[model samples]
Target: MINWYPGHMAKAKEKLKENLKVVDVVIELLDARIPFSSRNPKFDSLIGDKKKVIVLNKMDLADKKITDIWVKRLSEEAPTVAINSLNGQRINLMISKVKNLMSDKLNQLKRQGRRKKPIRLMIIGVPNVGKSQLINQLCEYGSVKTGNKPGVTRGQQWIKMRKDLELLDTPGILWPRIDDEEISFKLAATGAVKEELYDSELVGYKLLKVLKDIISDTLEEQFDLSQVNNDTLELMEDIGRRRGCLMSGGKIDRERTGNIILNEFKSGKLGRISLEISSN
Candidate 1:
């Protein structure tokens, strides 16, 4: 079970609600690999009636086919764009999409003689979904500091994106309660949730189990395993032995092996993997 409800997150929740009142649009960044798990459902109710854009980030680290499907499926609700924010891949297209989505709103402002003001935006997402990276790409500078771990952006920072656009960067907000096991595992697996909150062995086992079915070939290639097994524990043992993680009695060092599996998957060392499939 993954239980992570820091009291500080409540403050961030309030901050996002307050920031929404001033911004013209909400640009939500989600991990391309775990779109369903990464999405904070609270956003729909919190940013009510605000123009929203869905950015499927880390596209290169997710399955291209599923990412495409997600873009199409989510675009029905909001203007959606798939991008790898780390390298700014197709980030220009994202900018263009934002402009197009906001054109009607911008035109209304122009008619009211409000054309001189810059476009104000609020970016929110579950932790570690490339929110800061997208901000840097958009601003064309490393404005907001970024890190691999969650809870890195503890405070809100207002960043100017060129002369005509401004952004408010709030701490990434996750729903207070995550009841679904797979959602919990995916969030934990993607490094969106803090590592200390969940057990590494269980998460690694679940991740390995999923990959065993979805992308066994990738696992085989990465670990040089000639044969794969149905049980994640056995698979983990094989991986541990391959990686030379052993103890005095030559037992598989499960802790070290778990960390290795998680780190490799999170860093995309195993290959492009997507945890969620489109329901539609």
Candidate 2:
């Protein structure tokens, strides 16, 4: 079992509940590559009765066909849009959907002859899922600090995007306990959890296992392997040898090799791969 709920995340969860009273809508960002595993199950209870717009970030790094399937499936539950935050793809469509969701409430307020208010949105997701980057793209400036690693944002801050739009950026929070091992591996593989918390070699091997089944041709082509074998460990060793991740005694440096594989996968050097696919 892999469990990592830090002190700050606990506090962040409480803060989110309290802040929920004020926000009008929730923008739940998810990793497009691992949509199922990236979602925190606790959010359903936490975001009770609030309108939600699911934004699948990092679409540029995920398989396009898989992402389109996910978008269609997820839209049945809420307004879903696939966006590449780094390049601002489909961002305008997201904003339009949010506005549409709130159109009724906005019209009601107008009927009462009340003053116009900004649409308060809270952005929530697992760590390093591109919440900060999404906010920056919406604002067209870097209003918050961002890093490739998890646990970058430690507090809540309100950002003004426009006269009628306001965004609340919250720290990424995970569930108290992740009982599912496959979910844990997916989280670790996608950088949702810190690299120091788990064994990278094991995660890398698991990643290879998934890739070999889904995109064996791409994997072999990327690593210059003649063929992909059933033994993932042997495949890792072969990759390490090809990439020169070796120790002084002619042994493969497993840690270094693991990091290399993970970095390449995360950076999309292994091609556009989606760890999870929509069944529909």
Candidate 3:
């Protein structure tokens, strides 16, 4: 369940309109695990006819098979690349791709005698998808503050990375409307939404159910279970037992176990898993 936009997010809509005209290209980041759900329906309308490139970040943490499927699926409209921004090495390739795609604008600027000016690119995405990290990586670990939590970027700020490239790092923005329940669940289950509204036990159970369908053997191995079981609760109990999360009276600490499972999944210890699968 996605919580509605906060008061701060309302201001983002105003800021978005404020800066839309100045941006030459829009680098919209999509979480590789939940491409469709992570996409804001209003993006096309918000971005208008501006050059758009979809950066599928956190590829290292997502199921490769599913990522490939999404790549093929999303390639129909925008140029898409699967990248791990934390690693830094993949960023150059991403920048090169963006530069190539925005060459028409570069030519137009050249004709106007402003070719040497850095290309202004606006980076926008939902909170916590590594947008700030990507910007710092692209600019060689420069001055912008980087944090694990969302909304570190505030107001309109320009950072010059290279002689020909400048970045306008804006705060992460979410849409005002989230109409799909399934999308909300996937987002919540994966911690792509906020953590305050999520119950670790519920999310873990949901994740186990999904893994059992897609990668049962991996899930079984990770939790040290001998066999795949029909019941999710039974599997979670086994996981808790293996992890030694027991209460004072020796009862299984389901909530603790759930937190551990979800943490491992978030940290990529449960291997690359994708909550949302793309339709062909």
lDDT against the true structure, per candidate, is 0.86, 0.90, 0.78
Summarize candidate 2's per-residue lDDT along 35-76 as a digit string, tens digits: 999999989899999999999999999999999999999999
Q: How far is candidate 2 from the true structure (C-alpha RMSD, Å)?
A: 1.6
lDDT of 2 at 190: 87
Screening candidate 1 with a backbone cut-off below 3 angstroms (N, C-alpha, C), the clashing residue pairs are: none
Using all chains and alpha carbons, the TM-scores for the candidates as numbered come to: 0.95, 0.95, 0.91
Q: Which ten residues in a row have the lowest lDDT in candidate 2?
A: 137-146
- Tens-digit lDDT track for model 1 on 1-280? 6667677788889877887889988888999998988999898999999888899999999999989999999999999999999898988787777778678877888899874567788888988898888888779455778887888878777788963678888888888889998789989999998888888988998888888998888889899999887888999999999999999999999888888999999898988888888742
CA shift of 198, model 3, Å: 1.6
Best of the candidates, lDDT? 2
Q: Which ranges of candidate 1 are over 4 A from the true structure?
A: 111-114, 140-142
Residue 106 accuracy (lDDT) in model 2: 93
lDDT of 3 at 123: 88
- Candidate 1 steric clashes: 0
Per-prediction count of colliding residue pairs? 0, 0, 0
What is the per-residue lDDT of model 3 for residues 115-213, given as tens digits with 9 covering 90 to 100?
A: 455778888888788887788777743567877656666666887875367788787778775667677666665556566766777777877777777
Q: Which regions of candidate 3 deviate over 4 angstroms?
A: 111-115, 177-179
Candidate 1 vs candidate 3, TM-score winner: 1
